[model samples]
Target: MRIVIFSDIHGNAVALEAVLAHIRHETAPDLIIVAGDLVADGPRPAESLAILRALPNTRFVIGNTDYDVVHERDIEYDFTRAQLSAEDLQWLDDLPFAQTVAAAPGRELLVVHANPCDLRAAIKPDHSPAIIRPLLDGVSQEIVAFGHYHVPFVRTVDRYTLVDVASVGFPRDGLLRAVYVTLTFDGANWQIAHHRIAFDAEAVARDYAAVGYPNAERKARKLLEARYRHP
Candidate 1:
């Protein structure tokens, strides 16, 4: 079975369009998973949500930003939340915290936006075994797929496989491209591949000015011009 997993769209519809086109043209998969952070912090919240909503057979999870959209009492989120319809908010509110996908008969893949315990917890590529082991508590699946760090990585800890599918819109790897991961399970073993598709970063950055919020353009420009924070 072939499964494509992506996360952290963060409201950039342009980038999401490129990624969706690539998926349609390049391959057909059995399942699609959106780990989380589908909106907020970018230019096109409604458009982004529309694109994802149209996809078929896709599973979704709630991320930290997604949770904040519903519960946080902050003014910064108003514009993005306003663009969403009542149905959209309900969908976001109902998203699962985690899901287990059985790619093959006996091959199980656990999907979560971040750590199994907390949506805010991030598992960086360089974390020590001591730091990583606790995150696996109560997780029995041999393969664990997660996102939120916005950096793609495949790591082995004990007998478990950890995969971070990475971000689609606001990538912190400094490439300014959309990224996701595919996992192919062949009964016993799982194969992984990382895909990075390019989109118009400059145009999308300019879109922030018209996002209808205070200093939206400035905030967007700061994100676009900033250096990558993670290795």
Candidate 2:
């Protein structure tokens, strides 16, 4: 079975659309796994949720931001930012917190928004393996996927594969890009690939501008522009 994993849409429907198009042309996987953070932050959270609901075969688990926006205002979770619309929050509130499945015999997968061991478990990119390994013990899956750091990368330890696909809207790499995972089962082994690529920046930026998030729009554009130059 082949499954695609993605996270942190953060209301950027254009990025989500571009990534969906890429996935259709590429893996054509049987299932799409959403790691969470479906709305808020960018623009048009409601439209983003609509698009997510449109996917034919999608499974999901809420992200930390999703929880923050859903469960309560939680002034600590980027409270300075504007509050999401009642509809957006309601959609997020309706989502599940964590999802678990057995992709194949002896091969299991866990999806979450933040560290599986603890929602508050924070790890820097350069943290030691010892420090990182414990944060992973909380989930009992052969493969554990998560987001929230907004940094894209992967790590493998013991019998577990840690995939941090990053944020499609607020990437640390500085680009309007989407990160995804492709899981292919070959005999007894699981091949997990993390995919990241740029999408339509101007369209999403226009949405942000229209939504009155000029500050966020400017910051997002700068990230994308820097990536364009560097890449």
Candidate 3:
């Protein structure tokens, strides 16, 4: 079985579209898991949500920003919040903190936005096994997938396999292109593939302007523009 997992789509519809196109033409995954932050930093929150909503065999888990938006706890999300409908907010609210599915007959796959105990807690790529050990305290799956730090990595700790799917929008790992992870069950164990798909970042930057964030000084506008330029 093949599975595609992505996360941290902080509302850049252009990036999400490019990744989705790759999934359609290349990966053709049997399952799609979106580990969260579906909307937060960039423009086109509603549009981004719509794209995932239209996909098949997809599951969503809530990230820190998504939790903030759904719970109305963050002021930074106000602009994107205004663009969403009540139904959209409800959908975000209903998303699970973690999802576990059967990958093979005996093996299981666990998906979470970040750490198992905390939605905002992040297990970064640079972290040592000692730092990563505590993060796996309550984790019960053999294969675990998570996202939050916006960086992609795969590591094995004793009996557990950990994967970070990285960011579909607003990547911070020194690459401008969107990043995600794909997993394939090879009968014995799972193999991981890290994907970086290029999109029309200029168009996404323009979208930020069209969505009422024309000022370069605004944090949201600056983030959207820098997403294409920076790591």
State the lDDT of candidate 2 residue by residue for 1-231, as single tens digits.
887888888777788887888898988998888888777566766667778878998987777667766665543234313445666566666778678768677688887777776554545456678888877765678887787777777777776777776777666666446777787877687887878777777777676667665476564675466342211
The TM-score ranking, best first, is 1, 3, 2
Best by lDDT: 1
What lDDT score is found at residue 46 in candidate 2?
Answer: 67
Sort all candidates by lDDT, best to worst. 1, 3, 2
Give per-residue CA lDDT, model 1, range 77-167, as digits (tens).
7877888898898899899999899865757999999988889889989999789899999887888999899888999989889999988
Q: Please state the error at residue 211 of candidate 2 in Å.
A: 1.9
Which regions in candidate 3 have their CA more than 4 angstroms from the true location?
A: 73-75, 214-231
Q: Tell me, what's the RMSD of every candidate?
A: 1.8, 4.1, 2.6
Worst 10 residues of 2 by lDDT: 74-83
TM-score, one value per model = 0.95, 0.83, 0.91
lDDT tens readout by residue for model 3, 153-176: 898887888898989988776667
The pairs that clash in candidate 2 are 174-223
Q: How far does residue 1 in candidate 1 sit from its true spot (Å)?
A: 0.4
Question: Per-model C-alpha lDDT, please?
Answer: 0.86, 0.71, 0.83
The pairs that clash in candidate 3 are 174-231
